[model samples]
Target: MTTKFGFTLMSIQEFETWIDARQLARTVLTIQEHHTYSPAYTQFNGSNHFALQQGMKNYHVNANGWSDIGQHFTTFPDGTIMTGRSLEKSPACVVGQNANAICIENLGNFDSGKDAMTPAHRDTIIRITAKLCKRFRLPVNTNSIVYHHWFDLSTGERNNGTKNNKTCPGTSFFGGNKVADCVANFLPLVTQAGAPAAPVISASAVLKYVSVTASSLNIRTKPNASSPKATDRDAAALGAILRVYKETNGWYKISGSQEHWVLGKYTTDVKRATVKADTLNARSGPGTTFQKLGSYTKGQELFIVKEQNGWCKVNMDDRWVSKDYLVFA
Candidate 1:
């Protein structure tokens, strides 16, 4: 149950620390540092302020605050990479399960009617993603990475329709193919046989464009480092425009921002995207489940270590779990 990024297999705790830290060394800035407001923020009419604050508080509680175990690892917008929960710990970012995946918080209101993210933000996310892919051995492609919306438990209603009526990451974020594209861009860097080919972008090429339907994306600079120089960047607000430049080893080196990288799995490309349940309660038997065994829910993105019949055998929270409990989005 582990997610490989570069040569590293970040445990749940390590991943959580990364989110709280907001390691920007691997991030890029989409919008310039001094911007007025984010379009996505304005569009989200829900409790965006409450959401952000609550998310931050929750992250702290699960990883930093009372828990002191660090749950998430990083936060976008300010581009600061703080450390959070350990690989063995769990987080509260998501409902029901988070024992495996590290939840990252991107500042801004995603539910708002407008898009709040910028290209620079994407660049940062791509590079960080690329590095993680190489470290954990997870596929850098979009197929493995997923959005908050896409993460659904087996007990919850299908397609994110649940009786609890929870709204995570918001509809604006992780709405469409954007998460896929992010993973796609980063996968190449890790999968490349050797050094990646030079960026195939032209200076005259217009900035590639994608809508930041979500409130935020995890942006990085070098993919695996933590430095203020690399972390410095304005948050990607809603409705902000961005341009794509070139793809590198498991990363999308953006053109709009100085030089930023985003994880390949979070983009719109046609990488295989699927949603899986966190450590599903395993039973000695069946029917409403039998005895509850240990559980896992590690890694932001996981590689399909193995799969079979209606089930996919995958690493759980950097460990192994039963495939029968898994379900795709």
Candidate 2:
């Protein structure tokens, strides 16, 4: 195994072993499959793994204004896997559907008239996905493993290519990028490779929403301070709403399918509310004497973190607004 730009480049076998041994602290409900349409097969020279990875990172950071590469991992035509973003944080892929997702970008255009998929690369994609499903206890299905073509290019809705969408993962990726194509061709291979699917948990029905009150809150693998941190450097950003499935001691399990937990002390049960005032001042403190942070227009929705002295704290930071200007849902 070799490391480049803080990313680990590993063989398929090494990746399988490494992922299997890892104890993921964050919850991952979906695995996204994408194709790098720009950096076609010709860009890879077998030994330029680090260079290519760095180039992509630089583009993502400089052009896209993202902190790092969007995808969690990239698969090469030579059957190599290079890590990208940290698994703890949400990926930048798929816009609004990034939360709780692990994105995999296969290096090379897989369109029918574009780069032809190699046998080694094809086998590696199948097995690596299977290994991830097995290790993460994810079911091999359309909902669990998704294609970029399935979502809307603008709104990020799961339209399944019925409307405006990019032919990502390709027009002929694994036969096709449609949901039916995945069900018929791709999922069967993954199921065969990683047999006996893990049991699915039905915990979504019991989840309750809560808003983070602290500027940044830590997520843990277990509901205790001794447990390892589930997220990367920064905590869950202020105003981030998380769904809680279970509560123990004072910690809440934030993930329905994974053992991700966060402290309840820094969170508050919130209700969605809309701004009633045409232009309301967002303050740094609860009183009118506090500095103004910003302003919200009428009908703008925000989560009410807490209320103090007729002022409602609207975000995880010190941003507050008068409760008189909020219409709770």
lDDT of 2 by residue, 1-329 (tens): 99967999999999988886664444455789999897889999999988988998999999999988999999999999999987656688884456557899999988888899988899889988888887666788776788988777765656678777889899888999998899899989888887336545553654566866676688788999999987433356544667678999999987666788889998878666777887677777899999765565565556676889999886444578899988886
What is the overall TM-score of model 2 with all chains considered together? 0.69
Clash count, one per candidate: 137, 0
In model 2, the runs with Cα more than 4 Å from the true position are 195-262, 267-329
Highest lDDT: which candidate? 2
Global lDDT scores for all candidate models? 0.37, 0.78
lDDT of 2 at 233: 31
Off by over 4 Å in 1: 1-55, 58-70, 112-115, 141-143, 152-167, 174-285, 288-329
- The local lDDT score (0 to 100) that residue 28 gets in candidate 2 is 58
Error of 2 at 240 (Å): 8.3
